[model samples]
Target: MTSPQILIATLVAAYLYVVTPGPAFLALFTLAASRGRKSGAWFICGHLIGDVVWGALAVAALVGANRLGPTLFEALGFACGLYLVYLGVRALMTRKDALPRTIGAERPLATGMAFGLTNPKSYPVALAMFSAIVAPYIGALKAADAPQMFVAAFLGFLLADATLIFTAGLPAVRKFFLTHGVAVTRVVGVIFIVFGARSIVDAAQGAMRKTA
Candidate 1:
């Protein structure tokens, strides 16, 4: 099992990443804003189901780590770290007005599920979080232990996403968030950069240990 501090850090980072505005948020926002919270809940269910698949993939990668050797894990850390830094920079550079704000249809559940499944970012986000934060402590637990962490992470995402969708359905709240979206995104970008740097350091340390 991971130390309590790492576990808390992983959960916090996961929540922050999930809440950052992106394709998933836009999709949910459109649906919730157009339809209602009830529709949004169904949409969130679909999204959660898609996230389950992502969580499974993360666990699979961790399990595979045991066999592929430490070098592979180090390489993965570096790759995910660089990717995080790239995403952070991109988020920081992009203006809020440049993003899409299309309205949604009545069939929110199906569309939401489709969006969740098709959105390319989910897998990479999962990989980055797992590689940067979870990988170091994964060895302490049995391979079977991965599911619990996945479930916990998914619940956190679901709660945060559901709340956001519900709140965004309200015109005033949505307006406030959208108005301040740039500030929120900047904070998230900084957090991502910090995590990315940590991952790079961890990768370097792992490589050095292997060389030694």
Candidate 2:
């Protein structure tokens, strides 16, 4: 179990790790690029919700720190990897004019879940960092226990992703629906491929580790 300072520090590290580019990053970025910034904001919200779910799962012991063996994790990883590849391929195949993603009410949340859940990196990072950091707090009866930590993580996730979307993705958004949209689409398409391919490789490594 981690102490308070250690717990907070762990979370900062975890948040920073999440903030770095991964499937979630690419997903949010791509969504912003395809959809408008407002849509990107919702997608970011969805990502935060997914983080909260993961954190809660960790706290509740639904996902154990060590219980998820390499085998199981690897299998799960494969599922996410394949899904990302499918998305990436689809994005690449689309025409530039088709990239303006006008989202209905459902898609913002759905896309968020799709990106967060489908990224194997999200699980390991959450399982390893999020679970471990909050494990000690889970036992405490204090108000600053699980809920506080969850809020902190959620907020951290939102800010970090929102920054990226606003900085890089928003411009793409304009190009998509306004001008030079096709070029932006192509870039996003490449990004999806990169993100998806990376997921596949990481999943394979995990799988090999399990077998070995």
Candidate 3:
């Protein structure tokens, strides 16, 4: 088990990663601007669940599943990067005058989950956190302790993501976004595209480094 100090340190590290506006936040921002606050909240719920699962899987990989895990995740990263870029392009091309349609609960939830699960940077960031902050303290932890570690890491993810979603949905924030919805969407689209391009470049570099 991790000491209390180590646990706190790990959560703090995770928050640093989660709070940074990355692909995940870019995706959420697009949804909140185009759809609405309710949809953004649902998306946040889905993303939180995905983060927990990803955190657990990262712990499992470190514990034993490394043989195939890294390769599989890299491939997913490439695919997801492409998809994100496409979404960005689509957002930019949204009809000039038409308002964004109200998104159903299921759509945003599923979209958020997919974005979280396939976020190209997540695995690498988690690995870095483990090496820099977590592994130093819990290197001696047994496999049985994986679940506890996973939960600790996920708390940070939940808090960071939930905060962003709720803040974006605040009445003033939402009204401003909804008022200039088209402009907001275009801005988010640009952010997504740039982020996606970066993901692709990073994934390619990682793959090359692995092969070399």
Candidate 4:
């Protein structure tokens, strides 16, 4: 594949990575509904930090997984999984009369940074998304290609972030969230729990395999 093709593929992978619904999506939805688009935008901005870091790491891993090995990410996955489960349980325990407590409500940037960085699924999911789209071109990738790929992926993330901000700000979307905030929060909690458990299991399996 040519440079342009690889860049485009990487962009597509990044876009899909951000747009996929998960804990971050849920938090954004809650913030947008409760506060407004500005808060959502701030959240996205904060999350951008995590996106870039994870994206770069994912690319590095793609280029050098054999050299770096999976141990570090596996450990991170295990720790993040536990954190997610804790958050999920807290959300599940939210009172019916109260709005679900979102982290970083008072400080969206910090909350977003924490969410983006600590998300259990981000690294693996980003890796899988990029792998699915760009694997065919891996052999053709040179050291110089990494910078271009990163730029393409960053652009993709920006586009998705804009889309999410728009979606979160829509009157209809906000209204729906307002009406069903509790239910939605609970549902998200369930999802987080499931994702966390899966991460834990996957990490444990990886460890076992490594030991064996």
Q: CA lDDT of each candidate?
A: 0.67, 0.53, 0.62, 0.76
Write candidate 4's Cα lDDT for 1-212 as tens digits: 33898889889978877876566887898898888899989999999999998998877765564235567656655665676577678778868897644556788988899889998778866765565566556556666677888889899999999999999999999989778777777875676576667667766877897799
Better of 3 and 4 by TM-score: 4
lDDT (Cα, tens digit) per residue for candidate 3, span 1-212:
55676567557656655654445655566577666677888787777766776666656655552345455545545565676577678778867785544443458888777867777766654543343344334335456666666677778777777788777777787666556667766765675566556556656765897899
**Tens-digit lDDT track for model 1 on 183-211?**
65666677667777878888899889778
Which ten-residue region of model 2 has the weakest summed lDDT?
Answer: 132-141
Better of 2 and 4 by lDDT: 4
Error of 1 at 158 (Å): 3.5
- TM-score for model 3? 0.56
State, as a TM-score between 0 and 1, how close model 2 is to the true structure.
0.49
Name the top lDDT candidate.
4
lDDT of 2 by residue, 1-212 (tens): 33456346445634654565445555555556566566767776666766766655544341332254444444544554465456556656767456343333358776776666665555554544443233333324233354655555665666666666676455644453345544555554565455445545655765575579
Q: Which residue runs of candidate 1 sit more than 4 Å off their true CA positions?
A: 1-17, 30-36, 166-172, 182-188
Model 3, 122: alpha-carbon shift in Å? 2.5
Location of the lowest summed lDDT over 10 successive residues in candidate 3? 129-138
Best by TM-score: 1
lDDT of 3 at 194: 66
Ranking according to TM-score, highest score first: 1, 4, 3, 2
> What is candidate 1's local distance difference test score?
0.67
